[model samples]
Target: MPMPKTIGHQIHFAKTLSGLIRRGWWEIPEIMASSCMAAIGIVLGIVGVYNYEKRNGDNKEYKSVYMIMRPDDPRVCLLNNPVYTQYKRF
Candidate 1:
């Protein structure tokens, strides 16, 4: 006679879980690569930040240029853009 549906389903699920647990399933290369990718990214980021800080050290100064576009500012026509300058000596 066939086993009851409820018991059969429970047994099937348990077998799948047991197989995965016994097989070191997480070590599957695809899974491991994807799983460690985030951690590796974080470590690399930390290393980059540490290197940057070590090189730049304690000077908190940050300089940035904010460009404003004015309707009257003829530069918006973009003939003055660096890209155009590269085509010929300015």
Candidate 2:
């Protein structure tokens, strides 16, 4: 057995929620678009941090090849090799 006040509160909450949905405040497409935008924002933030560290050469595990500006450069071939090597200053 539920109290009358509790029932009233539940009804009020449901009505409020339904009103919000009816008013297009909680639409499916809007939710999906917002979710996608949030996901993209998160990914962009992660990529920005990665780029920042890459630019600063903070990740010692991955050697930064500064001289190899071109993608087709012979030096870029080193990136494909499985063996990890120490950073060499040219």
Candidate 3:
């Protein structure tokens, strides 16, 4: 029991939706490849951050790699370790 104007609008909407879907179908492979590469990059970055360790002294327990460079950064680790304990003063 729909009016003629409503039927016409519905037909127009369906046609445009189908056209957009058809165009998107061709780029599915490229979209999937990009997603996979982004995921791989994220995993590699995580591994690098986790395995990295930089300590001030050679005999000291390992502090975070970022502690020396960004001591004030609360987002990184903050131990009582000195910034340059290993280096000898000239």
Candidate 4:
């Protein structure tokens, strides 16, 4: 025999509520919230990688040709190295 419509609805509601209470059915809202957080984290991670690349892309070499001197030197030694001169204005 077919169940009454109202009774069917009530049974379905009870099943859904029971599932929720038992942590059986993770519904759309929970899935959406988790996915949204993962997406935000991915975007932030990409932004961080892009910023890191942008900050360090130009200068790959750490070698320097200038000699260090005391600040009390009467005449400041201007670094005349071509690489140093070209990058000084940057």
Per lDDT, the best of the predicted structures is 2
Q: Write the per-residue lDDT of candidate 2 for residues 1-90, one digit (tens) a residue.
A: 986564332322245756756545444668867877999999999999998877654434455663434867755544534466666697
lDDT of 3 at 69: 53
Clashes of 1: 0
Cand. 2 TM to true fold: 0.33
What local lDDT does model 1 show for residue 44?
A: 99
Q: Write the per-residue lDDT of candidate 3 for residues 41-79, one digit (tens) a residue.
A: 999988776666443233334545532456467634544
lDDT of 3: 0.56
**Global lDDT of each model?**
0.58, 0.61, 0.56, 0.58
Residue runs of model 3 more than 4 Å from their true location after superposition: 1-27, 53-90
Best by TM-score: 4
lDDT of 2 at 49: 91
Per-residue lDDT of model 4, residues 1-90, tens digit only = 997565332323345666664443344667767777999999999999899777655343344654566767743433244345444455
- Give the runs in model 4 whose Cα sits over 4 Å from its true position: 1-3, 7-26, 57-90
* TM-score, per-candidate, Cα-based: 0.33, 0.33, 0.32, 0.37
The ten-residue window of minimal lDDT in model 3 covers 6-15
Weakest 10 consecutive residues of candidate 2 by summed lDDT? 6-15
Compare candidates 2 and 4 on TM-score and give the better one: 4
Task: Give the root-mean-square deviation of each candidate in angstroms.
Answer: 13.8, 11.0, 12.4, 11.0
What ranges in model 1 sit over 4 Å off?
1-22, 25-29, 57-62, 65-90
